[model samples]
Target: MQTHARRALATFAVAATTGVLAFAVPGAAQADAGPSTVRITEWMYKNEATAGEFVELTNVGAAPVDLTGWSYAASGGGPGQVPLSAFGEVGAGESVVITEAPAATFRSQWGLDADVKIVGGVTHNIGRADDVEVYDAAGTLVDQLAYNDQGTGTVKGPRTDGVSGEPKTAAALGANDASQWRLSVAGDDDHAWAATVGGASDVGSPGTSRFGDGRDPRASDGGDGGDPGSGAGIDPHWADVRINEVSSDNGDTPVGDAIELVNTGASDVSITGWLQIDSGAAASATPFAAKLPDGTATTTIPAHGYVYFSSTKGLGSGGDGVKLYLPDGPGGTAGTLVDQVSYTAGQAGTDEGTDFGAGAFARCPDGTGDFTSVAFKSFGASNATACESPVTDPGAGGGSTLNCQPEAPRAPAPCPPPRSLPRPGPAART
Candidate 1:
């Protein structure tokens, strides 16, 4: 489905990994809170708009939750903290959004309902690999959402459905692990990227879903009115696309991470309006990484063909991952997960291009096989399989960049190296 409306909200982007948002000194973990049964459900850390970023909470429990004296702060220390005194109370099964944007502006941007309980005053900017904490009047921590690096150049955490999904719009229902977290699309699911509005790459729906896509989950004023069963707003490409190869720790080619995708189906695929999200790269900035600039060499993947994506943003050398979302035209919903691939330091050859995965992870046999470490990254071409001979370039220091530190050291060859990547084995039927 194409975007049904226009989204003007924008998220702020981190220009560089300058260690801006720091971790707060650890304190005793707090869990008990009052009557309200709430959990931190969704949040986007890449608040390129500063005001556009937000955190969503849902009352899954039976009782209404009052949050008069509650405070919102980052476990990962960032901007000033905000007290929830202004938010009044949140009814059962309802959702409320807390953001740095002025309440009116936030409401207008996401097209939220007046009764949805949108509030400003959040000085805490969500950061990569950080925690969102909510404390009660008595200073007792009620909820702490520890989100691993899902996305920033786009953000999603593990959905109850599959892979570590981005938390940008992760939907979690009462005690359930796997929930139908809606795909981030622009048509109707999420706000479409725009230079003046969301700064491109921005995808999320704060105060949108109350934990589920069922019509019943939308906020009090009446939900976004999407028909859940029909799958109205998803992009068709989501069904045929696949993330074939990703070069995150690109010390070998240091030209930046190169994402190679393939048309798994027999038809061609155009990725003009698609979104690319990065799992947090503490040392780099992925601001424009989500979308490609004008005149990119290739945006269409021919029948069973490959399109190499040269990213404007680089992946973390130590460890980082990449996510691919289906395209959404202007005002179109675009966050249907097309494919995603991630890597660790050792498995990724670490940032310096020296580790087991050799800083590159690929789908052996190109588009059909499960992803595994390859001899080296082969963008816009067939995947360099582990079964192939080892070939580290002499120009970049003879020996393979092998420093499996924090783990065991690795062999100098990508030829049949240990398969230590997380998403190993057969790829999930994404």
Candidate 2:
């Protein structure tokens, strides 16, 4: 449950303008985290015949990255701190694996594909409550991941072998949050699932990377962040962005259950790789955050611009909430939160016309005000002025705003209980 920044290259500093945490390095520049630029996406704890002790690296970034100058190291286990140099330039969305066991031995254990990249000479033994790291050419920390069997490490994982640590890789920063990982689902989270591939009985998909299609939420490119701008550090422009409005149930509505984002700043902000999470009883079962598609042309919101994300079933008529985050999730860590608003079932419904029968939750004065129930749906245009009745206490109606609150500190999502899965047999690589 704890992650240590092994190096002191950077320190935390709040952006005076936004009051958001920024890595205050002497010369921190624009750090762009793609998916998880060369991340230690998955690893297996050693158990005799159950699983192989190995570390998997993935280039979740937007572009290919060289691992030639990169290195892998393990701690809290057999190898003290022997940094092993890696080779190959991983293409975007590609995966390359390293292990101490024979490539064939590791493959047979996991039923991995022949084409899957594998390496031997992993002298380290993956263990319970162990730390594993991947560093860039400059030795900048790409990711230093730690996992424990009892859901006690930075990520809840493989208490037993064959069940590799399958952290969700969509959010970039979410990669590290225990809740965003698999294998710890049983008893840890409310749901459970498991898969056996390549004749391997492992409980996780070690080499597969799930993205946009609606799995995995962790993301990041490298040292700074992939929080779009927020993913790496605090964006001066983040303060001006707001969760303007939300519509629930009314899937029949043109926009279905939708969310609106507004930028109050003068200059446009790029939100590529940004993420949206719908947290509610219904959503909690399969909590998947939506990442903005890459490309400035489609991902940018002009100054004072308004953008709406529409869907069939994100909100629950009973009660649900929405949040916006920067894509800065580093391994075993969460992304920077931008805005969040939770609402009750009554406030989550279409207009019933009564005091509590309002149709949607909208900012009374538009983008910069508190959320009020309204009987209208403003897709991309301005909200209806007649819509009034701001919840005197946003929390009174089962609604709370993280970024909208006055002086509230920005929050990183706490690890959620993992979905359930029959743990893989305990045993690491040869």
Candidate 3:
């Protein structure tokens, strides 16, 4: 099956390059039932003043796509058709950027080295509204995307000069729908480029993976055949998955600190190639490269299912921050952040230094509620509704209390006793 898919893609690429290919617009009836492998993954109509606009294309098929005389056209705008000259080929699971800027300018601005196509004298007027179309050598319409200031299905408004537009995960088939499109998130490295380009603070991710939370074109639905660097094709949207609970202050014990995550979306989510960030001074500290639970490397969380991760890194009793990051590329850079939660020792009327010694903080409404103090530790279970009330511990000169609801008449199940701290060596004690 995989070999057949690659052959079909290679045939299509040849036809496209030779100008003999007859392709229909998406949704049109076709003799063949298979979907097109090459897709318009992303586009930036606007950019900094100095940088030229660009459209990114990705070959999701199993074979490389040849581009000899392809072109981009706008149905009802100036610079009607920008013809693409010989630009070599786009390999399987690889991306090629078509830009109005010279090759050098585009590379320097985006920090891209290769796989760039330059079309001089043709400027893309994607300002407020435009009908963008991709054509093969024979002028066959491969794909068409229309956007306006009024917006369409999932996209809220017109794509301004600085921001790029991308489709949502599982919504690639509905690209024209306004609601399916979203704005790109600028990375920390983009700040310098934004300054040089002289546009908004948000710079689009070009020649890279599609920005925002869209499906990874390079990823397989469940299999692992694509690039090793690309993450398992998981939806990178943080909203789909979240940190539901945290047992950060596990009574100063190394074994009790655990982090829980819940999938709130309708579909299953993969945590493959994802990382958990632990930042704070505590009994347990975050690991340098902690991978999620797929047994060996990666795993998936079924819809509405929960996955728990325990950390040896002692979380700060007073305050600590936890972050989840998606793997960006093979270089080990932190990709898009999936979700983050922070806790302060004394905020929200909770006891100051003593809260860490008391119990865990949980979210009300389970998967989608605000974090609050819980008297009972609900690891991998539903959270308690009532907040935990703090009491002073005179022996330790601090506060300590069993996990119990403040208003509940009866105490809930008590949390396991705190593990004893390791005794100091004889030499160290001396």
Task: Give the candidate number with the greatest lDDT.
Answer: 2
Q: Put down candidate 2 lDDT per residue, 1-430, tens digits, no spaces.
A: 1122211101211111122222222221222353346666666654432345567666666787766666666552222144444447667777667876776665654445555667775665555445566555555555655554333324444343444555544553324444354431211111111222221223344444543112222122211111123334445576567777788855745456877777777987766556666652111122222223221234667787777776423666545677655544443122444556766545656423223556678876766555676766665556755354433312233333421111112212221211122222122211
Cα distance off (Å), candidate 2, residue 35: 10
Deviation (Å) of 112 in candidate 3: 0.7
Cα lDDT of model 1 by residue, 247-320, tens digit: 66445352367776767677766665566555422112222332222324665667776666655545554454
Which runs in model 3 stand beyond 4 Å of their true positions?
A: 1-36, 47-50, 77-80, 116-121, 152-160, 187-200, 210-430
TM-score against native, each model: 0.47, 0.37, 0.41
Each candidate's clash count: 32, 48, 17
TM-score of model number 1: 0.47
Which of the two candidates, 1 or 3, achieves a greater lDDT against the reference? 1
C-alpha lDDT of all candidate models, in order: 0.46, 0.48, 0.45
For each candidate in turn, give its C-alpha RMSD to the true structure in angstroms: 13.8, 16.9, 19.5
Q: Candidate 1 vs candidate 3: which has greater TM-score? A: 1
Model 2: how far is 172 from its true place, Å?
Answer: 5.9
